[model samples]
Target: MPDVQDCLPTALYRAAQVRELDARLIAAGTPGFELMQRAARAAWRALRRHWPQADEVTVLAGRGNNAGDGYLLAALAQRAGWRVRVLAVGDPAQLGGDAALACAEARAAGVAILPWSECAPLTGVLVDALLGTGLSGAVREPYAQAIRLLNASGQPVLAVDIPSGLCADTGRVLGVAVRAELTVTFIGLKLGLFCLDGPDHCGALAFADLQADPRLLATGVPAAQRLTGAGLPALAPRPRNGHKGLFGHVLVVGGDSGFGGAALLAAESCLRSGAGLVSLATRGEYVAALLARRPEVMARGVRSANEIQDLAAAADVLVLGPGIGQGAWARSLLSGLGALDKPQVWDADALNLLAAGQLTAPAGNWLVTPHPGEAARLLGTTTAAVQADRPAAALALARQLNALVVLKGLGSLVATPSGELYLCDRGHPAMAGAGLGDVLAGLLGALLAQGLTMTAAAQLGVWLHACAGERLGRAGRGLVAADLMTSIRDLLEEHSPCLK
Candidate 1:
C-alpha cells in the first residue's frame, strides 16, 4: 500500500458527509460488520508498522461502531500473540449490532476486557476509540476523564479515526481532546484532520480507503478541495516573442509613513513573480529608498488620492492595503481607488478600513485577504468566533462582500462568492511572521494582472505562497517575509514554466 501522505485524496468531506458515504458504501453490497473489520485491520497494520517493537496493546473502547473497531483490533492483536487488553469506557451491555459481535469475538479470542477507571494501568501503545466524528458537543463524564488521562499518559497513542474530541466538520477541539502521535483514519478523509487544532492533535496521519467503489465515491460532492499540484491552475508559458506589454501591469498602493517596507515588499514580490510592470504609490519619503532597494519597481511618492489616479488608470491590477494606516492620508488614497473598477487584491489596513466602515466594498472583480482578527472585524464578531469555525467565516465574508476571500491562517482558505472553497495545508508554523500577507497580496495581484480569473488566481497564488513557506520552513525559524519571494518565483516557474 502507498504511504498515507503519498496517496491522500484531494476531496475533503465533513463528518456527516463521510458518514453518508459510509452508509452508501454499506448499501452497495458491503456489510457494516465487514467494513468495521476492514477498519480494524487497516488500523492494526498501521500500528504495527509505526511501532513494531511494541508487544502489548491497550484499547479504549466506547459503545458505537468506533468501539467495534477497537474490540475487533483487540481480537486481532490477541490472535497475533501480542498481549492485548481492552479498557471499556462505555458499558459492554450498552453495545448493540456489530459492536456486540466484536466484543464476543474479542472474548472468544481470549483478549482481556476490563472496565476503564482512573486506577487502571495503561501499557504499550494506547488506542483512542473513545469518541468518533459523531461527537457534536463537549466531551462528558468518564470519556472526558479518559481523554485527559490518555493525553497525560506520555504513551504513544494511535487514534482509530480522528482524535476522540475533535469536531470532524470544523477541526475545532470540543472542550478537551486526545493528542495522538499517529492517527489512522478509514474510508474518507475528514476535513478536521487538516485544519485549525486538527494538525496539532493528529501527529502522523494515515488513511485506508476500505475498498470503496470509486464511481460511487464520485457521486457525493465534497465540502471543499485540498490544494495539490495535480490539478492546480497554472499560468500559460510565455511565448518567445512575448514583450513587457504582453503581460499586464500591477500597481501596489499603501505604505503610510513608518510602514513603507510593507508596500515595498509587495512591489518587489509582484516584480519577481512575473508582473510585467510593477509600480508603488506611497508616501513621498520612501521613493528614493524604494528605488535604492529595488530599482525594477517604478516607485512613485504620492501625497494624495489624486496622485494615484494616473497610476491606477494605467494599471491592470491593484494591490491595496499592506501598512496603509487608517488616517487622513490613507483615507484619501482609498477614496481615489473608489471609482476604479479594475480587479484588486485588498489586504491589511485596507480590510481594516473596510471593517471600520470607512468605505463600502467596491463593485468589481476583487479579492480580500484577512487574517483571523481582520476576519472577525469584517464579520462583526470576535476573533475567537471566527477561529472557531474558519470555513464558515470565510464563506460568510465572501458572500457578504460578493468578492473572493482568502482567509489566511493555519489552514488558509480561499472562498468564492459562489460558495466554492479551497484549502491550502502546505504551509509551516515558521511562516507565522510579519509581511507574509503583503507578499501574498502582491503575488495575488500579479497573477490577476497576468489574466487568471479571481478564483483561479486566489487558489494558485495561495498554493505557491504556502508551498514556498513550506520549503523555506525546513531550515527552522528566523524566516522573514522577503525570503519567500525567490522561492515563490521558482515554484511558479516549476508549476508554469516560461518555456513550453
Candidate 2:
C-alpha cells in the first residue's frame, strides 16, 4: 500500500485508547507537560524535514493540546530563524495546562500571535493544529471557516498529530477535515488516520514514539494496526519435494447462470496464486465454457447441493459466494458447503445471504469480504453509518460473526475477532471494476490453503492485490479481471514473501 515503513514502536491506537495511555504514563511518573513537549519536538522534527527550504510558516491554533503542538512547532520554527505566525482560533485566555505553556513558549520565541478572523492571510506552509483526537462532532463556526480557508490556501500543510476534524478512531470527517500534505503523529499512530478518509486526508504519514516507555503501551490495548509488507512474517519457500497434494485443494462455489465470469475469475486467480488444485462448482451450462477458458481449473457444474458435497468435502479452503445469487441453487450450494470445517472466504452474494440472515457462518477459520454496502447489510446498518466509521464497523463485524472481516474501500481495513485491526492503503481506483472481489477471495483462499494464518493471509492477499492493481492502473483504464492474474503472479514473485 502507500509505501509501508518500518514498524513504529508505537502501535496504532484510538483517541480514547491513547488518552488513557497518556494518563497511565503520567501516573507511572512521566509528567503530562513533558509528554506534550516530546510530541511538539517530534512534530517539529518532521515539519523541518519535510519542508526544509520553506522559511515562512503559519500555525492554526485551537483550544486543545493539538493546538499546543502547533504553537510549539511555530516556536521551534521561529527559533530556527523561519518567519512564523500563530492564528489563534481559541481565546488565548482560555488556554490551560500544557497548552497554555505552549502558547507562552511561542510568544517568548517572538512568533507573531494573531486572533483568527475571516480575512486573515494564512501564508506559507499551513500547520493544522486546529483540532486533535478529542473531536467527536461536526466542526463548528470559526474553526470550520478557518479549515475551509486552510484547504483553499493551496500551501503545503504539515498536520500536528492527526488532521483536524478527522475521528482518530473511525477516520470519519466531522463535517470537514483539514487536508494535510504530510501528517506527523506522536505517541501512537491513530488507526483512523490509515482507513476510510484517513488516507485521503493525511498524506505522507510519519510516526514518532515521543520516547514514551514502551511498557506504558502494554497497559493499554491497541485499537488497530497498520499493515506493512515488512511487518508480515515470511512464508516458507516451496519445498523441493513439494507435491500438488501438499499445497492443498481449493473449492470455488458460485457462478450462477449469466455470471459464469465471476466464478472463472476466482478459480483462475486461485490457480495463478498457487493453489495446487482449484475446483469450480458452477451451473452445468458453463462447464464447457470454463474448461475452454481455463483448462487448468477442474470445472464442475452442479444443479444441487448433493452434487457438490464431495467437492466441498475435499477442499482445504472454500471460496464461496462469488456471483452467487440469492436464488434456490445458490442457497442450496452455500447451505451445503457451510457445514465443512475448512477455512473459508465468503464474498459477494454469500455476504448478502449472511447479512439477510439466511445463512450462518461457521465458527472460525473464515473471512468475510464486504464493501461498505455489503458490510452495512451484514451489520444491520446503513452504508453511510458503515463508511462514517469503517474501523469500528470492521471490528464489530468481526466480533459478531467470529470471522476475520475485510472492509474494502479507499483504505481497506481488515479486522479480527480478537480485536486486531489492519489498514491497507495500497489499492488504486481502477480496482473499482466488477469481479475484483472474486479475485480477492481467490487470493485469500489460496494463501490460507498454503497454511498462512487467517490474519496473515488476509494481510498478504490485500497487499498483493492492491499493489498489483496500482501497477496495472498505471497502464491506464479498462483493466479486466483476467489482467490481474498475471500482475498478481509477477508481484508475488518480485515480493518473494516477507523479504524486501
Q: Write the per-residue lDDT of candidate 1 for residues 302-366, one digit (tens) a residue.
A: 88888889999999999999889999898889875855889999999999999999967888698
Task: For candidate 2, give the lDDT of residue 374.
Answer: 97
Candidate 2, 1-500: lDDT as tens digits: 33545555426778888888888888989987888888888888888788888889999999989888888888898998998999999878899999999899999999999999978988888999998999999999889999999999989998888999898988888999999999988877788887778889999888877777888777677776666766764456786778889877999999998899999999999999988999999999999989998899999989988899899888899999999799989988888667678899999999998888788789688898999999999889999999988888988999999999999988788899988888776777788798898899999988888888999899889888888898899878788777898998887776664223
Clashes of 2: 1
Per-prediction tally of clashes: 0, 1
The lDDT values for all models are 0.92, 0.86
